[model samples]
Target: MFDVLQVGQQHGTSTDRSRIGAEPVLLSLSPTIVGSRGGAMVTMRSGQAAQAALREEHWQEMERFGDFLTDEDLAALPQTIRDGLIGVRRPGGMRYPAFQIVNWGDGTKEVPPAWLQLVELLAPAGWNDEFLILWTSAPNAYLEGASPAQTIQSFPTEVTAELRYAAERAIPTRPGGPGSWQ
Candidate 1:
């Protein structure tokens, strides 16, 4: 949690309240933008901190999850936004599209060369996003739930994730046992 604003102002300030000699009173503040103010402090208890909260179970699950995918399977994941796999992973459902990066030339069954269109795919955890073709050679996938589109054709580049895949990356605990390469 973060205190939007904490100012010591005068409690009894009439209509003509000025920055003159007035008693100190706690001021309620709501920040329009986070981390913007005078000595703003964000406090969180243990096991609640963003970094520490990632439980060990989630990490182990992801490690096991990673093992299922072969090098070819990992490499087979959609590299382009227009091209994504038919089935990936879902919590309870059968399958879902997992955002990934792939090459355009390396056409697969799901995405053919003719169907090279800018598309959207959910990121890890859950996200409303669009897949973008980074440089023609190496494309990177990103999720955009707040904005309108996926590609950052606008002036300011937007690279932010509204959701997360939980322990897929942060835990560092291997999932899926081992890959074929290993």
Candidate 2:
């Protein structure tokens, strides 16, 4: 059995521009292993083992994104270009999602026109990098089950509308009246 622990602020680093003054929240996995040898045998994973497993899992997830640029890789690019893309900070380093950029294969990367608008729409929300990555990758109801990352390029207008609606909902409002708390 594995239990997840939400660890707050493992490192004081964030790649997401919108998440100023905020650090990435890390999830640690703690697992208890059970075996049967004509009976029941139980073993507990040490802290270091759990951490190593978590790091491995993070790398596996990163690989699923296909090709990504690290923080060091992005440092070679212009600041404006770096600011236009979204990056998530993981155990080892920051990873910029490749879907937002067009790799020219000559060590050059360009942000698509629609990505600029998408980043702008997401900036004011102050969303952390983890949430930003998950939101973009996950199937959205507003998109009729299409992921934002998948449709943002082809359906920029629709993606923009969905982002606007999501941003509006993210704002906390006093439903009762001024000075009222929910």
Candidate maximizing lDDT:
2
lDDT for position 63 in model 2: 66
* lDDT string, candidate 2, 1-182, tens digits: 55443455333334678887787744335434444435866455666457656655655775676557788888888887787777776657778877776655587656766667666666665677766666676566767787677776555434467655654454444575322355
Q: Ten residues in a row with the worst lDDT in model 2?
A: 4-13
C-alpha local distance difference test of each model = 0.31, 0.63
lDDT of 1 by residue, 92-112 (tens): 332322222323345533332
Spell out the clash pairs found in candidate 2: none
TM-score for model 2? 0.49
TM-score of each model, in listed order? 0.20, 0.49
**Clash tally for model 1:** 10
